[model samples]
Target: MAMTHLQPDPSPYPADAFAAFELLSSAILVIDDDGLIRYANAPAEDLFEVSVRQLYAVQAGDLFRDGEQLRQSLEEARRHLFADKRQILEIDRLGREPTQVSVTVVALDGQPWPALIELREIEQQLKVDREERLLEQAQANRELLRNLAHEIKNPLGGLRGAAQLLEAELSDPALIEYTQVIIQEADRLQTLVDRLLVPHRAPRIVGDVNIHEVCERVRSLVLAEYPNGLRIVRDYDAAIPEFRGDKAQLIQAVLNVVRNAAEALSARIAAGDAEITLRTRVARQVTLAKQRFRLALELHVMDNGPGIPPELLDRIFHPLVSGREGGSGLGLTLTQTFVQQHEGVIECDSRPGLTDFRLLLPLP
Candidate 1:
């Protein structure tokens, strides 16, 4: 099914004919008649894990494991100038998991680069879908948790007050101890309910926020708690500009993520190898919560710790779901609420030794 190797033909257009697509979110590749890659845009290079100069050095067929199928698609594309030919390919590359890429080939007649191929990694689309679903779930949980917390909160106060009065009138020491236990447990549950209601009561405090400052503050707070063995690293992009957001809410949101990572590193911390990295970068042409933004701030909180349990990965942000013993599980829920208030998103990816919590917020 391979096409006959065509001789080199001089293209009439300038070398930058496909310049407009370089900034496109999808990967763009322009293949010459000989099947040599003449141009690989930024996203394409990123998708293939190859630089433009290096991408040119390899034959186009080398990028995919099923080269014959790709060649057959190309042959068909070459025969029909106006037809759209598509194939899903597993891009073969080193040090990266094989990616499922949807390859779309469109023929351009009377052009130097006779074929334009677009490569879109399906994983990114799946990631967006996952984020949207998480956002919706978080919203629903917030409403349900708020109402449930209130329902439990009212009777809790009466129970504690009754226990206190019963303890005051008791003369037997053994029975007094039982009343004391009841009061203590009631107080503990009340505190938990107060935490559940905190996010709803906090007002949005808007201002220009520098993400680095937020990271630094969270680092300081986390280090104060786990100072003996934990190390916080800052990997920041100095060029990222400030955007309008709730500084306090952003601080709390990032704090929850970092703190959760730190908590997960308990074994690592005890072993004297705990580490958390706060990374910041500028994301362009980004979409969050269904709205597109020309620029967005990308913040990642990464930890070298035992990763989140696989069973709880999808529901970690839901209220009262925690992977750790004695965890209240409200941290990530509040974090999600705060980020969504600013029209942003928070997502987590975890494996055995690595965990990444990414926050994507549109920049003004």
Candidate 2:
């Protein structure tokens, strides 16, 4: 059925009567008691990915995969028409890869039975909810890994001690050598277990942290590694506000990104052309981890080096994935986890001669 359009009659109300509807974050539609769509806002066009004229050609139920459920919701809204409450409904879209949407219905005055429908894309909300759950799961896994590592360590120590005792008592040279091999292998296993437990240890979160302090700490540490070859530069915006967070964890997070950049710049450093810049600024009206905020802190680490390999770029944040040979590959993953704990996001861009890592953190 073709959608019926409702052009408002000129009245004494303000010229911007539709302003509230246009500014709403939800996709909105106006309908009469007959259930014909009278109007839709910009968010409505975005929700359906169609122009107003195109959207007006179809019935409200036609947009949903499960039309019956939408009809039921509409009926429910009519039953409680003017109760001063919002009626929410969830529906699936009618398409190959169906998307979910949540809608709210409210009655509007100045008509016999005019109703307004507000729609929200639930797919993005679902993705955010999934990631939050994954983060929680990752934390749980870290705790389990820590306990398992400690349990393994106790047995490893006993095995190493037993091997040492056996090597001392053995009279045959070959048997004594085998016992020494057992002790060495146990020591190697212990080291691996310690590495596994590192992320699980609780960080001490205290003090009002000036992000510049964290950047400087990372800068000093990186320069200490390549004192003469690498040059660390700062481009700080002193007006950035202080945010409450775990100082040590923030330092480690910055250290990992900066140190990785320093490592990538090793060859250029040797050639006396290496440069790493640490920049900080305040971003307004930022969104991270699906939540929108009025302001945020943006810290960027940029380097002049052979950029990350294209093939390894996507998986850089995955555990055990690295661009450098012999790299343990846990640094970026740990950095992501730490920044996420602080309700922030880390993104990277790389080319042949330049690579940049940007961290966006909300101001608390």
lDDT per residue (tens digit) for residues 1-364 in model 2: 2234534443333556557776554678866555656567776776676677766525676666655665565665666644333333444333635556766677655644456677776775564565566566556656666787799999999999999988888899999889988988998888778777666667666668899999989888888888887888999999998988889989999999998998888899889989999999997545566666667999999999989999988678776678888888778878888888888888788998889999989996
Best by TM-score: 1
What is the overall TM-score of model 1 with all chains considered together? Answer: 0.71
Scored by lDDT, the top model is: 1
Give the Cα lDDT of each candidate.
Answer: 0.82, 0.76
Evaluate model 1: give its lDDT: 0.82
Q: Give me the displacement of residue 211 in model 1, in angstroms.
A: 0.8
**Ten-residue segment with the worst summed lDDT in candidate 2?**
84-93
RMSD of each: 6.1, 9.3
lDDT, candidate 1, residue 273? Answer: 91
Provide the TM-score for each candidate, comma-separated. 0.71, 0.63
- Per-residue error (Å), model 1, residue 126: 1.4
